[model samples]
Target: MTLAFDSAGLGPGFADPVFDSQSVFRSVLNAVAYPGAIERLAHRPGAPEGLDPAMASVVLTLCDLDTPIWSDAALSSEAVSTYLRFHCGAPLVAAAADARFGLIGDAAAMPRLDAFAMGDERYPDRSTTLVVTVPSLTEGPQRQWSGPGILRRRTVAVAGLPDWFWADWALNQGLYPLGVDVLFACGDAVMGLPRGITVKE
Candidate 1:
């Protein structure tokens, strides 16, 4: 049997799998807990063709064999697919509804948040977690956010999102505990937008 390690355009994975993942995991947690605060990723994993370094680190930290991922056309290249399979052991799914995690290469072209797997009332934790690649986290239209993890209202800006993204997020917020969570990546930083967060544009 010939074992192939040909990853189309995929680059190297984590330099220190265990420690790097642990560090990335902490950043992810801080992002989620602080909602709009930008958390800089300490790990610099090799990113695939269409993915950014921050998003790639997030996938490596959170995805695994148990997670099913959905990616947009720009991010669905063989390089990204093979990279995820080899490093994270995550399976790729065609439909967003079936994915535990969704990777969006172009935030402006991303599907509606409702298109993803919104967990049921019984198990709201089963909803999908979206990892969207954006141009910049600190350079865009500012929005005020208030939610569970936030101490008070926080103003933050995220570039490269569609014009209707705020509107769509408003609708998603109405879904309460049954909606999908999102993490926006820019360069080596990430910002979380959990379902509990409410955004005012």
Candidate 2:
């Protein structure tokens, strides 16, 4: 995808505002705690125009020199990669399993959840994190979510998800200690689906 950025409010600089960093970290913490619930954020830094704000926020907060990131074909822009490398100091990896974090620009084309690295029983936290960018968070087919962070099985919808996404997610969850955690980003809204969550079609 060709990304066009509007930096009118941000001034003329490639760097995302410092406030964006703080907001992203705080929001992600809440997401991990709440799981499967959507949280809205402001000041989507490091994103080009038309790109999801939450996606930019995540790339800024989670990626660093110690992490490896893999991007889907749509998000494989030279500008995007350069910005991430220059600001976050993260290394870009070619393989999904080798990456600590993966960015999926096209939700329809996302790989099966099982394709990525799943943490072992001894270290469940070692699994990879997937960041998926969708068209919108509010409109789509709904799914039932029940897990540690959920309250009595809540109903939610994530736009741009493929028909088999939930099925793949279920299979991944069955793997227990060996499954990747997924984060969905639409505009400035985000929702986390940890490895433990149960998603029903």
Highest-TM-score candidate: 1
- Candidate 1 lDDT tens digits, 1-201: 999866556678999999999999999999998999999988889977688899999999999999999999888777778888889899899999999999999898999888998899999989999999999998899999998888789999899999889998898899997899999998899999998899996
Backbone Cα, N, C clashes tallied per candidate:
0, 1
lDDT of 2: 0.80
All models: lDDT?
0.91, 0.80
| Model 2 segments more than 4 A misplaced | 1-19, 49-51
The TM-score, computed over Cα atoms with residue i paired to residue i, of candidate 1 is 0.96
Model 2: colliding residue pairs:
5-49
Model 1 stretches with alpha carbons more than 4 Å out: 2-4, 7-9
lDDT of 2 by residue, 61-102 (tens): 778898899888887877677666766789999998888899
* Worst window of 10 by summed lDDT in candidate 1: 4-13
Residue pairs clashing, model 1? none
TM-score versus the correct structure, for each prediction? 0.96, 0.87
- Native-to-model Cα distance after best TM-score fit, residue 171 in candidate 1, in Å: 1.4
